[model samples]
Target: MNQQAISDLITKMADDELVLGHRNSEWTGLGPVMEEDIAFSSMAQDQIGHALALYRIQEEHMGGPDPDAFAFLRPAAEFKCCHLVEMPIGSYDFSLMRHFLFDHAEAVRYESLLQSEFAPLQQLARKLKGELKYHTLHADAWILQLGRAGGESYERMQAALDTCFPLACGIFEPGEADQALINDNIYPGEKVLYERWLDNIYRVLVKASLNMPDPAAITPAYGGRYGQHTPHLQPLLEEMGAVLRLDPAARW
Candidate 1:
């Protein structure tokens, strides 16, 4: 196995979870309802847990920094999360659509990793799939309800989907060592995952009476993998690390 390829892949995955987890956590006291507030809070914790586990693998197996320092101390440019995960949690429609699109991609990614030749990742994927199953279920149910409501609710969902589709495509942006990882059976590769994600989400969207935009009509939002981010990320990172940064020597 190419260590660098594996490490890079792990780092990117961890960063995505860390950033999106923080975004999800923002809904803790602010969800549309009590149930939703609790749900997002739960999912946010799961994402952060996933991030911690992945970072531990990197630190133990790839000689990366410990999870705390690596996650809280990295410069925005060093993060490898896709642009999709970095966008601000907008209105409920946007956040919900983002969850629907992003989690499906995540489901496919972890399903592919289940067979990874890398043992640590394979084990982690196994555990994560269980948590992600509920996430997809939640997203699917909400998307269906909103998309078929036949009024402003449906319109808002459709609009959100159109806005998010291109950004979601960025989730599958080819990583620097993606080909090598694919060749080594470390992963099935982004292109394969992207196709699977499209199929998976399409099945649900169709059932919801939603229309998918033409793939060719939308240019995939890209560049987050190469250190480019939306302006929203830095402030998020700063807020996420504020307490930790305040007293570098303080133990949590």
Candidate 2:
């Protein structure tokens, strides 16, 4: 097996979860409703927990850095999360759209990982499948309700979807190690996952009366996977690492 390829793949997944987990946490006390607040909080916890697990796989099996340090100490340029997850949690509509898109992508990715040749990843995928099921359910339900509301709610959701679609596509930016991962049976590769993700999300979008932008016409926002990111990521990294920087020995 190509350990470097496997480690890079794991790092990308872990970084995505860690960054988005904190973004989701921003809604903890600020959700428009108590239920939403609680829901986001719970999902945030799940994402972070998932990140820790992936990081542990790297540390224990791949000879990677400490989970805490790797997650909190990495510079923005070293993080491998896609740009979609790096963007701020904008309005409720935007955030909801993003969550819908992102969770579904995650669902497909993990489902594919169920067949990974890597035993550790396959086991982790099995455990996370149940959690991701509920996450997608939550996102799907809200997207359907808001999309069918037939007023400002529906309009806003459509607009959010339009804006988020391109960003969501970034979730599948091809990795340098994709061919290696596929050859080794560690993953199915991003292109395959992207198609599956599109088919999966399209069903819900149709039911919601949402029009998905032509992916062929949209240029995905890439570069994050290659250590390049928007201006937003550095600030987020600083904020995320503030506590750790203040006390490097701090334990959560």
Name every residue pair that clashes in candidate 1: none
What is candidate 2's lDDT per residue for 1-252, written digit by digit as tens?
999999988888989899999999999899999999999999999999999999999999988889999998989889999998998999999989999999999999999999999999999999999999999999999999998889899899999999999888988999888999999999899999999999999999999988889999999998888999988899999999898899897666
lDDT of each: 0.92, 0.93
RMSD to the hidden true structure, all candidates: 0.9, 1.0
Q: What TM-score would you give candidate 2 relative to the actual structure? A: 0.98
Stretches of candidate 2 off by over 4 Å are 250-252
lDDT of 1 at 173: 91
Q: List the residue pairs that clash in candidate 2.
A: none
